[model samples]
Target: MERISFCPTLAAPLNKSEVASSRNDKSQWKTKENRPCLMVVGNDSAAAGTLKEALGEWGYDVVAARNGWEALVLAGRRPVDGMLVDMDMPIMDGRTMLSELRWLGHQMPVLIMSNESDEQVHPQLLMEGAQGFVLKPPHFQSLQQTCRKGFAK
Candidate 1:
């Protein structure tokens, strides 16, 4: 049988306290403990919303940022299990944000999402410590598998 974790509705009106309580209740659901939180960064609101939905459905706590600077701020507040960054963000590009995250001593893996999925971009991004690259309109299978592996407990 397939395993399913807790993923509340994206449009749900639950307050933060309710969500936090649910997250802490291990035995409440027959799911694993400590599902990873995801921070998604992109300038496109639509894409960000879509990914937010996907990640939420995949049973991850989802947070969306419109740019790298916002992502950085969110990342600094708490250690997230994974990140999905869009290369063309305002103020800071994906590469720059990635480097800054590294400089801040963050060891979390980053996945870049962009329109241009050049063959060399993956290698280049990886060289800067990014874990992987996901092309825009990410494949569901790839996204699920990568996130699972990225957040393996």
Candidate 2:
């Protein structure tokens, strides 16, 4: 199994008052305990590392998982505010992971990140549950905005 490295620049945890205030308003966008917790699942170590770094720079606390199975275990142990999952991987693919996650009652917003073009991706993934889809080597700003939108609602 490959190692998953996390960036070391995460923001401090949120205080109780802050959590209370954020939860009081359903319309307000809440960060995960001050910094949003993002789980990034992909098979390529280099790509996942790059994404982890970028997301960390953007103020997210990121957890990198090599495949969907690993992602599921990580998600089960902690609360993830959002997820960015690759469409293809060994052990478990993103689509199956999404289906399993939904069946298990995990409603965390998921964004599919794949090498496939929009036309190549299956429509069922979006219709079934994914909050959004992003092409691999995503534009940083666009990815960031998509993440923000997922957390907003």
Candidate 3:
């Protein structure tokens, strides 16, 4: 596994399928994402850095956004197949970002990664149609497994 160099999306014309496929070889990740895009939104540079490392190592194309507004703005123009969001973020919270995307009819599978150990990921709390949630800095293998599982679903 290698720590791929990720240049944050400063708003560009991104191809969804190309981005998703960059995470892994098509043969390894055969999940039906359909849309071909993966959005990773986080305020913490460290968290985003870790995810970029994972996603890059996984060989998936990634679009990194620093906050909720940026994510929504980027996602609006490009169709994302999947997304990983941080629960506590600046500008807008993860819940709000997810809600806005849903409102706009984006159906990408959104995964939430949070540092709030005391809080659990429940349907009632995850209002943005998010499909998965894993606490931050989980065991490396567990985090990897969780990400794989999320994309699988």
Candidate 4:
């Protein structure tokens, strides 16, 4: 499947203390370890790597899963503040993953990413418990805006 290629200038990862202090009382950005973690699920290693590095630079602790199964294991094992999932992947696609997550009572906001046009499917995805849908080649601004709103509470 085609993936978005992002060109983010690498930024330093946030230290544990920095992550702790940066979060406010209202922010849902804390995990069991008290650090915010975001899970990125996709089969595109190159894209996932770039996205993970970029999110880390922005002060988020990022974890990656090559497929839906790995993602499910990680989420079940620990806290995930949010998720950025690609629509097409091996093993399981984004829709199925989202369904399973919700069925298992995981409520963290999830955003689906795809190269497909956002004409119809996004509405259905939203009904299925997604926070939003992002078209591939997603601009950082849109991603940041969407994430901030989702994680604000």
Give lDDT tens digits, candidate 4, residues 7-106: 1221222232332333333344455556568899999989999889878777678999997767766676656789999999987789888876776567
Tens-digit lDDT track of model 3 for 31-105: 454324467899878777777777767756678899887887677555556888887887777877776666555
Q: List lDDT for all candidates, in order.
A: 0.72, 0.75, 0.67, 0.74
lDDT of 3 at 139: 67
Between prediction 2 and prediction 3, the one with superior TM-score is: 2
Pick out the ten consecutive residues of candidate 3 with the lowest summed lDDT: 2-11
Q: Who wins the TM-score comparison? A: 4
Alpha-carbon runs more than 4 Å astray in model 4: 1-33
Q: In model 4, which range of ten residues has the least summed lDDT?
A: 3-12
Candidate 1 lDDT tens digits, 22-103: 4454343332545677889998998888888988898887788888767766665555777999999777788877876775
Each model's total of backbone clashes: 0, 0, 11, 0
State residue 92's C-alpha deviation in candidate 4, in Å: 0.4
Write candidate 2's Cα lDDT for 17-46 as tens digits. 333344345434445567877889999999
